[model samples]
Target: MAIILIADSGSTKAEWCLVEGKKKKTFFTQGLSPYFLTGEQIQNILEEELKQKMKRVMPDEIFFYGTGCANPNNARLVKKAVQKVFTGATVAVDHDLMGAAKALCGREKGIACILGTGSNSCFYNGKKIVKNSPGLGYVLGDEGSGAYLGKKVIQHYLYSTFDADLMDRFDAKFKTSTTEILEAVYKKPLPNRYLANFTVFLAENRGHYMVENIIEDGFNDFFFNHVYKYRESWTLPVNFIGSVAYGFKDVLEEMCHSYELQLGKVMQKPMDGLVKYHTN
Candidate 1:
């Protein structure tokens, strides 16, 4: 039986699946984004984390999909790194959005979206992504994402726009000052991740009108800027894969209803769908 290995990665983590005939195994490692890690670093992760997990079995084929891999140079960096780890394996690398498209839409035409630390969307025409809205990362875009939600929450908190009860709760939960928040956002590395971390607070306090409003506004921006731009959005099923979408599914559904969007599936992780896509 031929062995196949697949990886779906984001900026924070990588999920790996190894398929040997009918048996499959899943594991995780640090993310392998070429935007953040060097070829040496990616190779080191595969050698130290993935190679050890597979033990005696080496894959015949390796498919790696990761953020920042839309660029050919980035894709080459990831492919080269994977090749170094398994010299005998055929390595294929592509963008994480493509992986999402395959996982969410399979061989069917639909709209695929990612709402994690950051956000992105594309119109997938069965075999490939025919159109994509520019995902300008967390700095300029990524509306309706965890980072975006957290950013709005922070803004409201800093501006004292939250209700008094919510304000007390926010202070009690974070015990942080405006200076600290600004420092983390401006000076720290991976500000997007740092910003996304605050979504936990929103999750904990879900259903509160204040929290709901913030999340709803973010989702609205996401649809307005990204999803709505696709002509197929009106006719096709819009599917999503990511933590934010899965976490606030009710709000997402409400927003989709508001927009009259045909909501498909919302998956926290795309690995399971990807496994089926590849195995079949």
Candidate 2:
């Protein structure tokens, strides 16, 4: 059996897939982003969450694709943290955009994008990323990301522009006042994640006219600002691989139709494709 642990992660959470030959089991934990967490902090988190999942089999290799690992220094930070937990395994760390590309296009050239808590895109030519449009994280950019959506939803609530019933429902669901939200967002470790968590609630209430507008607007921004900027990459099929893209696929497709861009597959998670890529 070829034992391997593969993870495709964002800023808020990490999904781990343990593939032992044909059998696979999945687990989840807090994501480790070099931009937010230190190597020791990541090691501590993995020691607690991954320890229980490693009882039966020891992995031969670990492939970790996460946000903020594109730089060699960031990759080394992640590699050190992962090494602390899976001491014996050979670990390979890379950027999440590359993971999206490999998962969405396999060995073919395509434009790959990620719209999760944060967002990213790159031009992939079969084996590696040749060019990438820089993402300004959640605060400045991450246009179609969950955080961007959540920010819009929260603004509507705080501005009192949304329907009264919708505002009431949101209040009942989160029980969060404006003051509370301000505190969480300003004083939080991962404010982007704090904001993005509301995407779950937004998804539930997406049928509302105002919510639909918000979704459409966010997606449009992503396309016009990030994806469309990659002039040459769009000549090939543009594939999306992330939670936000998969969840609001209809809205995303709408943006694509308007932009006249060729929309490819939208996979919710990249672990399965990553597994197939690595194990072959």
Candidate 3:
């Protein structure tokens, strides 16, 4: 029996699945984005967390799909880290967008998007990514993403846009001060992640007009700027894999309707589909 190990990672977490025969074992660890963690740090994470989970079985092949693996340097960094741990396995590292394409589109051509802590998209022709829309990280872009939504939420709160009831609810939920918010956004390491944490508030206040407007505008920007730029946008079924898309699915669906685009699949995570793709 061939043992295949697969990892799907984002900025916040990584889901690892080990497939042996028909049985599968799952494990999790903090994300290992090359933009944030060094190759040594990634190796350390696998050695300390993932290695402990896989007690006995050694895999013949390892596939790692992660956020910053598009760049050759980043891909090399992750590949070296994985190779260091499972010395005997043939390791392959690629961008998370490719994994989303494989998971969502399968063997068909379509548009694949990721709207988690960050956002990215690509045109996939069944086997590989053909054209890509720039993600631009959190500071410049990431429209329709958790981080983007959270930024809007905080901006409203800080700028006194929330009404009395909403203000009270926000305070009750977070109680965060301006000083702390500034520090986290400017001085902290993972500012994008820090911003994305506020999406819980938006989720909780889903029905409010203000909240709905914010979400709608963000999704509109995403479609207008990224998805609409592709020549295949009207012809293809747009698929999404991310937390924000699943959490705010109603708005996502509405946005797709407004834009006259077809929404295909909205998966919170791509691990299950990826397992099938790799195993088969």
Against the correct fold, how does model 1 do in TM-score?
0.97
Residue-wise lDDT of candidate 3 within 28-137, one digit each (tens)? Answer: 99999899999899999999999888996899999999988989999999999899989999999998999999999988999998888788899999999999988888
Model 2 agreement with the true structure over 1-280: per-residue lDDT tens digits:
6589999877778999998888888999998889899998999888888867678577889999998898899999999889888888999999888888999989988889999888888888899998788889888999999999999988998999888999899988999898899988999687998899988877898788988888888988888887888876457888998889999988878777878888888999898889888888
- TM-score between candidate 3 and the true structure: 0.96
Q: Distance from true position, residue 114, model 1, in Å?
A: 0.4
- Candidate 3 residue spans exceeding 4 A from truth: none
Q: lDDT order of candidates, best first?
A: 1, 3, 2
All candidates' lDDT scores?
0.92, 0.87, 0.90
User: TM-score, each model?
Assistant: 0.97, 0.89, 0.96
How well does candidate 3 score on lDDT at residue 226? 94
- Residue 26 CA error for candidate 2 (Å)? 2.5
Give per-model CA RMSD: 1.0, 2.3, 1.3
The segments of candidate 2 whose C-alpha lies over 4 angstroms from its true place after superposition are 36-48, 84-88
